[model samples]
Every structure is written in structure tokens, then in C-alpha cells.
Target: MKRIPMEIKVLIAIFLAGVISVLWYVYDTKAKRRAEAAAPTPISQPIDP
Candidate 1:
């Protein structure tokens, strides 16, 4: 078995974090679009004094 150094481990961790963050952003944008599409607009009614 080969041993990995601390620097390589740290780089791998950082790379994984970046990939996860990008995926999350893509997912969040899709969710927001779907929610907005499904959401209804509000209407204002007139009130008499």
C-alpha cells in the first residue's frame, strides 16, 4: 500500500468541496425555477371606506 501526504489529502478535500458546491448551486437554481413556475401571483382587492 502507498501512503499519501497531508498536502495531497488537503487538495483532494478542497476539490471535492468545490464539486459539491457547484452541484448544489445547479440544484438550487432548478428548484427555484420550478417553485417560481408553480407559484401563483397575488391579486389586490379594492376596499371601500
Candidate 2:
């Protein structure tokens, strides 16, 4: 059996991290949209110091 090189392993790890980040971002965005849609409307008010 041939062993894998360290550089290739590092590259694979980085690639996996990028893929995971993209998936998480998509899931988070969808969840945020759903939450926003389900939220109640807020009363109109102006911010005051």
C-alpha cells in the first residue's frame, strides 16, 4: 500500500473546510429567512437617544 503525502492531506483538509463552510452558510441563510418570515411584525417606532 502507498502512503499519502502530507501536502496532499493538507490540501484535502482545506478543501473539506471550504465545502463545509459553504454548506453551513447556505443552511444558516435559509434558516434565517424562515425565522424572519415566521417572526411577528414589530410596531413602528423611531429610535431616540
How does each model score on TM-score? 0.78, 0.79
Each prediction's whole-model lDDT (CA) = 0.83, 0.84
> Best lDDT goes to which candidate?
2
Clashing pairs in 2: none
Tell me how far the alpha carbon of residue 12 in candidate 2 is from the true structure, in angstroms, after superposition: 0.3
The candidate that achieves the highest TM-score relative to the unseen native structure: 2
TM-score of candidate 2 relative to the true fold: 0.79
How many times do residue backbones clash in model 1?
A: 0
Residue lDDT tens for model 2, 1-37: 8999999999999999999999999999888778767
Lowest summed-lDDT stretch of 10 residues in model 1? Answer: 39-48
TM-score of 1: 0.78
Give per-candidate clash totals: 0, 0
Question: Cα RMSD to native, each candidate?
Answer: 6.5, 4.0
Off by over 4 Å in 2: 42-49
